[model samples]
Target: MEDLIEDKRQQTGEINLLDIECLGLINPRNTYAITILIYFLENSQDWSVRQEAARILGEIAFGNSEAINALLKVVRTTVHDELAASPDFTPNLESNSQIEFKQLLISSKILHNKPNLDFRASESLYKIDPGNQEAIKALINLSFWHISAWCTHDDAIELLKQIAIGKPEVILKLKKQLQSNNESVRGASAEIIVTVEPNNQEAINILIELLCNGGEILEETQDFFTGKRILEHIFKAIVNLPSPL
Candidate 1:
């Protein structure tokens, strides 16, 4: 795979395989080689390559030292305008001192924009222990959109609430979205009920309120759970903890 990357990196124009090299390192089919590549990316002075490497590491969110360091740089980078990302972020030059063309931001965008791309996190902590809190915590910061509609009902909800505690912006939007007039929002609301409670009392009161209120969500194509099961999930939450986290 790397040989393929090397061949393409020597391209006269934009390196066609630049992204492939980064992706391979992100979630490589091989471990030792990829780890070395990741370290190399982390140490590279070129912000372009560093940015791409950071994005791939961010996807892991497992806080492995090297991966965590790379991702921390990205979290900081996202906040900066022309963030002093890579110490060597310079334009490429051709033989005549003419500016050459090559940009790593494009590749970085794909990886960062889609943190839950799944394949990237393979063989890491997420693969071994799906419930690692650190990774979930990182997702709260970087990957809310993907988590918002994921199939994990209760766990997804909890993660959202945890995130909301720190980021009111995300919570307000998500909660407001929960009751959005859209049918999908109505259905998707179920995904977070277990996880969106701001506090225990609020969670408990909402559960009680929902049960009495039928957990009604605009009465769309389907009645929430199964039409007959309007409040099954919420009711279960009420019955089990009576006050979710």
Candidate 2:
């Protein structure tokens, strides 16, 4: 495994999906396995390899603080890099302005240049630490801002529902996002809340409003499709809600 990791470092084609799968099939509790997976996750040039490493780390390194911290670093760095690559990004801005710019860019990036390593890392972090605020926030951003087909908005929302089960703070954050000006953000947030808290009248009301009145926030050319997607989320949530007394 160490040799494979080295070969991956020196040559991208030397390692492939089979190598990652073999690594995953090893005893997850093996310390060397954790170390090798972390190395691949942090150093590999191949995003797919890194994503697999992240997934395995979550499965094996459940309570390992070192592994959790590494996943956190990946999420933070990936998100910052994605935002920095935005066309509207400006360097040397004031601290507050930079922060605001990040928030704005989070909701408006139509094209995601980077792979979904950050999403995979954040999902792993959630598996390790459900209460991790950074992971929850990253998932929220991916749910709303990321428009890729590989990592759909529903993927993030489904994960958030699991994380929000007993985490009030996560629920609160999702509820707050329901009020976001971005219609997609609101719809995504509501979907999570309703899925987690079926009796959440506020979230149910918002879903109804989004279904009836929400515009296509995903794209102008794909308005009908995107709006239909949001409606699908609403219908699914409503169907799953408890029957009237």
Candidate 3:
């Protein structure tokens, strides 16, 4: 196995297209085993080779979400911040250098973003209806390692909207967070979704429920993270909720 991997790597270095073809044949769908493929996809000195790797990974990951996320991590880490300062936001140009800069924004997020792949993988596995233990195990690892960074309250709320559409049960998790003691987490958790889309009835209902009937949540005036209107937004949400009391 290592011999085959070595040949593929060496072949790419030598600019051997035949070797590239062989590598593709060897690992048509098994990116997990084709670590050599990712190595080239990620770190080849040649832009053409790297581009080819990126292209192939895109195709490979179409059905296997694990492959997709693995590639996403590569994209995230290799993202060039200096180049991404003003993202194109052009609506579908995947190779825009601005994407490299977007990683900076991911770190700047006001709330936490968990990319560890645990939650991601579990969710993907469930979506595929794989119905087994291996998928759960993969998801757990994915979460712990990759997706566990902070996001803007905007990003979190946007994600919640996406989640709310597919899995209303996930709203239950957001519902629990609306009652949190930490002002930032709770405020961001509660208002993030409604602020972005404004049609989150369940989320809005939970926010109302928290403000009117939930326990006393102390307010802290310190600015913990920059650039997020998480708490101020939460206060607004509180005032906006209709009262039965």
Candidate 4:
């Protein structure tokens, strides 16, 4: 059966790859299936093939350490594009060298971008084992990345809240963030708690204290992390809820 699936995968047919995935679902706990799926995930040239392999790996190896680690590997993979690795400073360089030099001189940057696979893997880890500290940590690490235009910042925050649910250590981590001297960190921590546990008294108190002390960002300041709109909503949410006592 493994040989047949491998044959199908080598054919480079989407339908054939999907058939192998169905087999994975049928025998999620099979060692052969896990091995095959991981192979395709790491080595497949086709993005769809790699992506499906990852999706199935998460579902099948949901709580298994090896499976989780494989997913983490997928998420950890990064494609590097050197903006200006070697600056052409020779006088005899081609005409385009000057243009490239101008661009490089302005800013030589190597931007690190995480793939969607990481998002899927992190979510699957939490889904399979919400209490796994490593999974939660991975999700937190993912959150630190700059969200693309296609994805809203709120999406990451919501995902983080999901990680915090039923995880006391995660909740405590957020609470600690709330104590940071940085207002942005405190504001973010409070906002996260509001979503994770809306009725939590500590969350409410933090929101209230932030309102009284730090106040809101001025109209002129366009800071994304320490804005007034989120605090306004949090305050309203706490006000509308009954007392915790």
Q: Rank the models by lDDT, top first.
A: 2, 4, 3, 1
User: How accurate locally is residue 44 in candidate 2, as Cα lDDT from 0 to 100?
Assistant: 70
Comparing 1 and 2 by TM-score, which wins? 2
Q: Which ten residues in a row have the lowest lDDT in candidate 3?
A: 139-148
Better of 3 and 4 by TM-score: 4
Check candidate 2 and list the clashing pairs.
none
For residues 1-245, write the lDDT of model 4, one tens digit per residue.
67776676578643365655677678776777777677886666455566677767767776776777777676555432222222432234467966767655533221212344556666666666656666566555444323241242355567887767787788787787766766545655666777767777676776677667534443323555434555554566467656667
| Model 3 alpha-carbon miss at residue 124, Å | 7.8
Candidate 2 per-residue lDDT over residues 97-216, each given as its tens digit: 667778565535423424367778888898777578898888888887334543546677777888788888988988898778777677778888887788889888887876666454
The per-candidate count of clashes, in order, stands at 2, 0, 19, 0
C-alpha TM-score for every candidate: 0.34, 0.72, 0.37, 0.61
At residue 244, candidate 1 shows an lDDT of 36
Residue 115 local lDDT, model 2: 36
Name the top lDDT candidate. 2
156 Cα displacement, candidate 2 (Å): 1.4
Q: Which stretches of candidate 1 lie over 4 Å from their true place?
A: 13-65, 76-78, 81-135, 141-201, 204-245
* Cα deviation of 137, candidate 2, in Å: 1.6
Give the alpha-carbon lDDT of every model: 0.43, 0.72, 0.44, 0.60
Q: Give the lDDT of residue 167 in candidate 1.
A: 54
lDDT of 3 by residue, 1-245 (tens): 54665676687744343454455556665554335446665455444554455545444334565555545444344223313432432234466577646644554431132232123433433333333344333322231111134332233344344545544444455556666655445555556446443665766765665455323432332333432343335557666555645
**Model 3, C-alpha of 212: deviation from truth (Å):** 14
Question: What's the residue-level lDDT of 61 in candidate 1?
Answer: 35
- Which run of 10 residues does model 4 get worst, by summed lDDT? 81-90
TM-score of candidate 2 to 2 decimals? 0.72
